[model samples]
Target chain A: MTSLPTHTEKKLGLAIDLDTCVGCQACVTACKGWNDQGYGAPLSDQDPYGAAPSGAFLNRVHSYEITPDQGAAVIVNFPRSCLHCEDAPCVPVCPTGASYKRVEDGIVLVNEDACIGCGLCAWACPYGAREMDGDVGVMKKCTLCVDRIYNEHLPEEDRVPACVRTCPTGARHFGDFADPDSTVSQLAKQRGGYDLMPDLGTRPTNKYLPPRRKDAPDMSAPLAPLLDIQATGFAGWLDKVLGKI
Target chain B: MHPAPSVIVFTVLSGMGFGLLAFLGAGLPAPSGWAAFFHWGLGYSLAVGGLLASTFHLGNPQRFLRAFTQWRSSWLSREAIASVACLLALAPVALSNWLGFGWPRALGLIGAVLALATIFCTAMIYAQLKTIPRWNHWTTPALFVAFAGAGGAILAGQSGAGAVMSALLLALLLAAFRIGDGAFAARAQTLGTATGLGTIGPVQGTVRVFEQPHTSPNYLMREMIYLVARKHVQKLRSVTLIGAGIAPALLLPLTPPSLLGFAVIALVHLTGAFAARWLFFAQAEHVVGLYYGQR
Candidate 1:
């Protein structure tokens, strides 16, 4: 019962544009607000009014500073959440058949009622997408707004996930990757949307478009001695490693 | 890996119990009447106590009954089934030995295999996790079976076999540590691959976390990003090598053939088993820790 579906009918997922994300955390707030009442268990905060306040959140935006050889350091806001992998490791490792991936839309979800809270699923996941709810003792993760996305009451524009809806910069996009014509799929093809930790072979549904090059150096101009910039730092080290591979 | 005391206790105690059961089932130091009662009593206490301790590792332990339903796919479920089967299969033999009924010995033999499997299942729970490269190797299961076999041999008063198993265990433990030290690095999971930023293009300096998502501890940080024992891992590794492996290997061959002698050797071995189990969890490096720029 914990085995993954042979195939999902529709790969419904998000395409997060890192180039425009400002790391305002508005989507995090929106995700928290919607998931608190919309999902299986409400997000709980321990010691919210006291020292060491912590709470469960479906979506979190992390800021990273990227520095290039010859320019200012560029800060990219990376939002971390469940990638809804096709071969989700979390599902097969579940001892109670609590963690499962949907065959219809390919969204990974935890059945709170069946969950024994053994936490093996969380350990199976390399991306740390699943979190054990301290208050409820069941695993919780990004549902991709399963309730809201299919709800008939919500208007067409409002049917998207709360994270996509509240992203002020329009950095988050929602669509089905199953259809080649879908916006998400096209974006993936055009912008090179890639998986997180491709080495693990999870085959994540959600894709992240790399931040566009910050400063464009003119290639047509003749090579000048002063302009001969040798790549250094992490990218140089990375090139050497990739060269080894 | 948080190295919760419940899980550590479960592995150490249950491992020794199952090991003893295996040896007894195989007719090592076969006994009758009062002797059988004493041996079975000790075995069951350790086995049952260790199994019960695992129940505390669960947040909703009452629902652990559901853990049995997914054995076809889950190792933890398989372990639950195996442990129960082993205990049940051995009960009749234990009673037969105690009361001189002379019931079929096949029951004990079946239980022995199951107990060995139970130990393997416990190891697979950690070994199956690819997220932790260090524990994902075959050595994990080998180490588990070794510890149980050595510890069980000591409890059964088979000093020669105990000494031999302990020496093998020592060799495996050292190899596991040596291989494990490079397992994470061999995988090359870095902040670069973690975020896919390292593959994008060259950067000015490096890809680094400018700010974390939250100020306070979250479930991911609490459960996966544990680092309390990182600094003292070298010391703890020594504790495992000396206590669980070396002491038993050297002393078992010299100890007199007596229950009291085995008890002392077993105590020394079990102490090392506890420390080794602790290091198994403490030293495991989860890939999720890369998000926080950790191992």
Candidate 2:
């Protein structure tokens, strides 16, 4: 059962814009709030207010400062979750049939009932997408908000992953990547979206838009003198009078 | 990469157990009566005990039975299935040997094959992980086989010279694996490749870790970012080579063939195996750590 399906009907995935993400962690909190309450297991905290608190959460944002040669340093906010890879290594490595990919939508999920919590899947995942819920003793990861996305109770417009719905900067976009005309696909094409560690060959469904380059400050314009010698003494009085005029 | 003690014990002990079982099942010297009992006892105990210890690593040990159900793909599942099959096949051989009767040669052959297969499955569990570049290599399996063969030869050998030769060969092979593994450079990916920023320019000059995602250590950091000091690891590596390889190779030849001598050699080898396993896990650098700049 751990063997992936030959093909999924739709490649439902996300397109994350690195250029627009401000790293506010709103998506992280929003994902926690929804998934914790909505469906399946709650993201449990061991010592919520204690000295060393650790718990399981699906979505996490990592802030990185990247310095390129011949340019100023760039701060990149990398939000990571389950990539729902075309060939997910985590799926086949599970001893139990607990970890599997949905044939319909290409969403990788863990069947908590079947999971032995051996932590092999976590090791298999290159992105470190899976985390163990120590309280319940089961592997937990982002389900692409499966519960909310499919719920009829929620308004149509709001029927998306909580992280996507709550992104203030609209950096995260969710859609079927199989459709060439899909908004996600269009964004990916326009921004030249790329995969993280493409050499690993997981063929991650999610794409990251590279950070846009900021134009270097123009140095051709006339420069101002650092110290105004004329303004220091008698010329200072004359300059002050000229400035008033 | 945390070098979980349960896993370390499982790999080392189970490897020796199965390796000895393979040798015994192949009718090595065809021991009679009490000697046969000792062989069967040591082999079964090591194999079963190692399997039991492995369950301790699982968060939900009660679900251990489910692990055997997915042998079609998962190496862990194959390991579980193969372990059971190997034990079952060897049961008859052990029983026949203990009762002073010769078992069918074909039955012993099957058990021997299964035992080796089980060890191979165990090796594949780590060998297949592309995420950990250190573990994802042919040398991982080769090292596992070498360790098992050396340990088993000491326990199962009828002659001192044979045991000495096996241990020496193990030492040589261990050195080869270590040298080869160390010499191999990581060419596939780096911090820039991990972040998809290598396309932009040189990442080292442009990037730095401004802040970690969490205020404290998280599961990913704890599990993947295990950083052992180089000096400490070098000391431990010496301990491993000396205790597991050099000591046993020397002691097995010099000491007279006695239970006490075997016990001393086994102890040293086990310590060496433990150290080697610890380094194996600790040294493995998972690609995920690149995001945190741990690698």
Candidate 3:
């Protein structure tokens, strides 16, 4: 007889490639749309169409403009979501064990029925992945589209997460990071990717590759006489307003 | 941070409970009949519920006993020890009151001091966490004490306090508000320190949101992005100053010893105190805001 899979043995997770990523937010949109209608209660909004309409989003992208002393403007687009860490801090903090990391497949999920709407998990998380579903009185976050990934009805390739599948720039990738031979692991190794805020020592599964540049730009180029003049027509006025050439 | 509703409820409920018990032990007159029973039962029940709710904040509730070991350096540990001590002190006081010992005045004093100490310890837990700038303040402990006193006084008035004690408690509530304002100033100073800038001076350079460190809101923003309108803060302060402060001060001195007056005072104070506590947590900013490039 074949042995059944145990929680400790199986590992599942995601790896993102920053090298090829063009900063598109396809993954963010896809995650929101998928998680919004999936197994858990929809992310609640205080004022959906009114002023200050803020709601819970499972995934979001942050753009950072890093200006090195002698280099061109480097815009680093960081997509933030649940890292689904092997040592997930959010799990043990939950009093009811509602927030738990699955023994099998290593997926961190929230059991809505058991959640008491306490925001402790939210406080424990350094990533801010989790949010309170105020309407249902429970915490919610990215499940990595657990239901879709394991659905037998779907095609084998389509069984992967909606975010991974929808990513236009191929920035988001899903696989077992535990297995060194997996595509994500190989990519992470090859590109020398780094985790966000590694000092926290959460050992986040998601890795980000720092933006690389080849040569420094020359800022000492001689300026045109028209450009150097402080006063002129429309172009001069625009330059004065923006404080830029 | 997302103030867990259970925790919010727990703190408020327990503050009232411990506060009421402490006040009763502080030489306040004994309440009569069902009112007195509720004063004791509700106070202890809320205290238990608050402690239980706080367990949810821990990574391992089962291993919470280990927390007591760190009392040497940890305010959380001190809070745990103090809370347990308050419970132990209350046991004898409760037993004596039941046995018709005329409300064991000495034990009452002990329980009251312990209860206030627990509240102070609870505030210190947050104040000690250097990461959360909003919590790390001398005012936090004072605020917790005030809330406890206010909540307790309100409950006492409802449970039948004579005009003198009511007036005295009311005065304490006003003193708490003044202390809270001082705490707010401290919080603002600490926030400025966290940003690596001194004081609330105007920005010297053209500040622009060029790029953020992350694409999405991280833990810092989620916990500390507690934005309330300036106008609303002003309005709430005014209401608290009057309802929780001035009204209690004026009415307690004039009102006759009646349950109706007490109930009105209790309800008004409870609402005002809760608002004050909420604002206390919300208005305070953290040092982590510096990472987001916000001053």
Alpha-carbon RMSD, each predicted model: 9.4, 3.5, 11.0
Error of 1 at A110 (Å): 0.4
**Per-residue lDDT of candidate 3, residues B1-295 (tens digit):** 4444555666777777788878766756465455556667767887888888777654335656654554544455577788888888876666555455565477778888999998887776565544344555565676677667766776666333323333444465455446544543454423223221121122112222346634454334766665545347767766666666556656766777677887787777667666666665666544445435542
Identify the superior model by lDDT, candidate 1 or candidate 2.
1
Question: How would you encode candidate 3's per-residue C-alpha lDDT over A1-245 as one tens digit per residue?
Answer: 00111344445667765445666778877777877777788766656676555667777665544444443545556566788866565665454546677767777888776666546566556566786764666788888789899999989887888889998877778888778898878877876655644444456776654444545445576465558656689987887888864
- Candidate 2 lDDT tens digits, B1-295: 8888999999999998988888888887467788888888998999999999999988898998999889999999999999999999988888898896676877888988998898899999998998887788777777787677777767776446435545664665466446535532544576666887756522334455688787877788888788856447777787788877778777777778787777778888888888888888888778888878785
Say which candidate scores most in DockQ.
Answer: 2
Assess candidate 1 and give its TM-score to the true structure: 0.93
Candidate 3 docking class: incorrect
Lowest lDDT sum, 10 consecutive residues, model 3 chain B, at B196-205
DockQ of each: 0.48, 0.63, 0.06
TM-score of each: 0.93, 0.93, 0.60
Please report, in order, the local distance difference test score of every candidate based on alpha carbons: 0.89, 0.84, 0.63
Query: Which docking band does candidate 1 fall into?
Result: acceptable
| Residues A65-142, model 1: lDDT tens digits | 876655667888899999999999999999999898999999999989999888999999998788888798888899
- Give interface RMSD (Å), model 2: 2.2
Off by over 4 Å in 1: A216-245, B201-205
lDDT top scorer: 1
- Candidate 1 vs candidate 2: the DockQ winner is 2
